[model samples]
Target: MDFTSEKKEAENNKNTTNGNNPQEIVDSSSQLSVADGNNSISKEADEFRERQARDLKAGLHPLKSKFVFWYTRRTPGVRNQTSYEDNIKKIVDFSTVEGFWVCYCHLARPSSLPIPTDLHLFKEGIRPLWEDSANCNGGKWIIRFKKVVSGRFWEDLVLALVGDQLDYGENICGAVLSIRFNEDILSVWNRNASDNQAVMALRDSIKRHLKLPHSYVMEYKPHNASLRDNSSYRNTWLRG
Candidate 1:
């Protein structure tokens, strides 16, 4: 079975809508004041993002956090690729929006990647491993999509994550995009799994940011569960 043909057919489905809109995610609440320093922070977050966008507009873009991008691919005939960690390579670290876009433009999009490839965009200090101390207590929210829409979905979510539009308030660690044969899974990792409030907030924010309908489903899985399974991509526990 030539999955690439299936991928092309999937791309033609056109279920993915145009969602690169920032205003759709960040609302007028972004204008609220932070007088007591405890007021609604959606405004502050919006302000911060506006500033960042302005910086990017002026060719001076910088983000609140530094992020490292990693790439992993399974080679068909390469004996050098032994383990998941073996094929993984740290690509580049970007702190600015311009810098990220430069890399993004040069790299292949999710739809262009071969099956079994994965991309990791984690905070500079945190590796994308589930066992990493920074992620040990955290969990991931997985959004699965068909190849047709997954590429756009991945890009929009990455922008939101880096822009801090999700507004989980620093509870987020980073995000991962896993490309597979039948589908692609985009998951956001946070710092605390037990923090149900934070998890749900982030989940809802993702749905809102992507402007997804109520019927869409997002899956949550703890890092601890991944440890026992030995593979982040399959066979573990699922929390709604």
Candidate 2:
């Protein structure tokens, strides 16, 4: 039979199989219709979303996954005091998640270093320099870890930054791990020096998370002065 003839025969058979009432057949078919099907699917989607939200509220830590960018200055060239800085621009372009671990794994640990060097973990657009737009008006909270403890301390601090264990992350521009002869340091860079609330909140959060010792002192300094500008506010800051 032709397409139309076949379709007609099928409908006739369907009605006959039912009560032979066309309206009853239509009503029965309407219950299984695409529009109702779509409504059920939409309801299921909403329920699934609600359940997920509830689970998240019930202390289910949200899975956080994202690219992290880091810069290390302890490369052999910098350690040798070659009077030259690494090509900063090239490092910025190299910032990425996988690149971060690859860079960390291939580099010397902080304890093995003989000079003061810094590893900067910041968002891709941001440069680690104090004068960069994101850093210009910022400050950092300094954490001094003894040189002998550099290995464990460095690993912990780096993990904190990468895993976003710090508070006020929106105001956080980056973090730095500075390797010195007698001490290793970790510092948190904030986007605004005037954001006292965010800065303090971030400090408190970190201290609580790490259960830092009561004697540990954290110092805050604007990035420009940290870069060793003689005339910056930090100079006046120290005198005060």
Candidate 3:
């Protein structure tokens, strides 16, 4: 999952698919911005549309839905919404396969990201915030993995998401990769916590796509529980 190899492969694929020079791909990292509340979301949506239009003209294959990448460096002891909002920064938004690779190639690998850092990939217009209307009634399924395998798992999850490999993809809102001191955690967010069938289907789909071993335990926690406890990874229901 290193950038050099992935970039080369993507470049080759682009050349084969549309006969366009790889140089046409823009570096999306330069577009990173910190959200200034509601206004930022509105502005981002407009920008996303404009960018997608240009990419379409370039012959890139469009994805079913657009997605935004977000990064945040947590303050060790701070857990409030105000502080969290301040730390989160929007990296870029992509609506096509080529755009996704352009963004992904520039991102630091999950294993290399510093402790207390989080990388989020969410559907466009859906902020990663639990308070977002799209997420308020939802929950997430989290899987913890050793640091060494973080990159592979994160990439697999991203591919499955954008490729629409999941049966319950409509229920999915986004995903997060948290790099911590000892382990990396991956969480997939859904739009409805009350939809048991959809939630379980999402979990199954994730396991299948990731080829997750049965030995690994998965935990599900409602956003309401996180709001009450002010913790993202506490008091969860576990499935082995």
Candidate 4:
């Protein structure tokens, strides 16, 4: 329809592609480039050693342990936002142990990011949006965290997801942190909404790892429900 509009929207994505600024240096990849000129040999050896150590520490299925990182700014409707699909492809292309940490280091924490924006990390081949074939018929188990408690909760949740701690880890498509003024929300998407067994398993896994108190409650809602009316889902699932 509007090719010009799409072109302008694509240009706005410059910052997204140029990610990893203000480097946090969390992985060997970032360090390798710095070993320029004379010290390249030593740097290569050090990097090799670091990689071996990482491989040793990697738990079962090291390859699957890797997660893709996606960032969004606090903007309405993601309107005027960067090319999301393109950015996701970029992530998949560059995904590696080093790239994951580098991307994380550069991006703002969910709590620190402006409102309405989100940071999503899903297994490779899985898009963050619910529309992906992997997610189309699925749903998410959402846990709400107050703004004051969001930072550590977010970190723990990320670790839990990437570390493959969820009960139905294979069913887990990805996780999302939706920022809001009052309370931040974390939703772990599963591949099938109708799979009661898998859904229950995932919910229990989250509660166990997160160690939610007896007073706390988690809600599961279908993506279709979310798209139709988030409030209806919340009301039916949430209890005081």
Tens-digit lDDT track of model 3 for 1-240: 222334666644442322111121223333322456688768866776887787779987677788988888888877779989987877777777766776666566676666788889999889999999899999999999998988899999998887778878889999999888989999999999999999888888888989998888889999999999888998886564
Cα lDDT of model 2 by residue, 1-240, tens digit: 012223344443332231221121123342111449789659756765765576567643221222233444344433222232342312222222332343334334556544645556675456666777778898777777887875776666655665567787667776667776667777777899877788788888777766778888777777767666532223323100
What is the C-alpha local distance difference test score of candidate 1? 0.70
Top-down TM-score ranking: 3, 1, 4, 2
> Which of the two, 2 or 4, has more lDDT?
4
> Regarding lDDT, does 1 or 3 come out ahead?
3
TM-score for each of the candidates: 0.70, 0.57, 0.80, 0.65
Off by over 4 Å in 3: 1-57, 238-240
- Residue range with the least summed lDDT across 10 consecutive positions in model 3: 17-26
Question: What lDDT score belongs to each candidate, Candidate 1 first?
Answer: 0.70, 0.55, 0.79, 0.62
**At residue 36, what lDDT does model 3 achieve?**
67
Candidate 4 C-alpha lDDT tens digits along 1-240: 112233344334333444342222122233211337459647645765665567657631133444676654444444321454443322332223334343444455555566765667787667776568789899888788888887777777776776667787878888888777778888888898998888888888888888787777688888777656633136434332
lDDT of 1 by residue, 90-181 (tens): 76666665555544444556766677777888877788777777899998888888889888888788778777788674999989888888
Clashing pairs in 1: 30-43
Off by over 4 Å in 2: 1-103, 227-240
Q: What TM-score does structure 2 among the candidates reach?
A: 0.57
Between which residue pairs do clashes occur in model 2?
A: none
CA lDDT of 223 in candidate 2? 70
lDDT of 2: 0.55
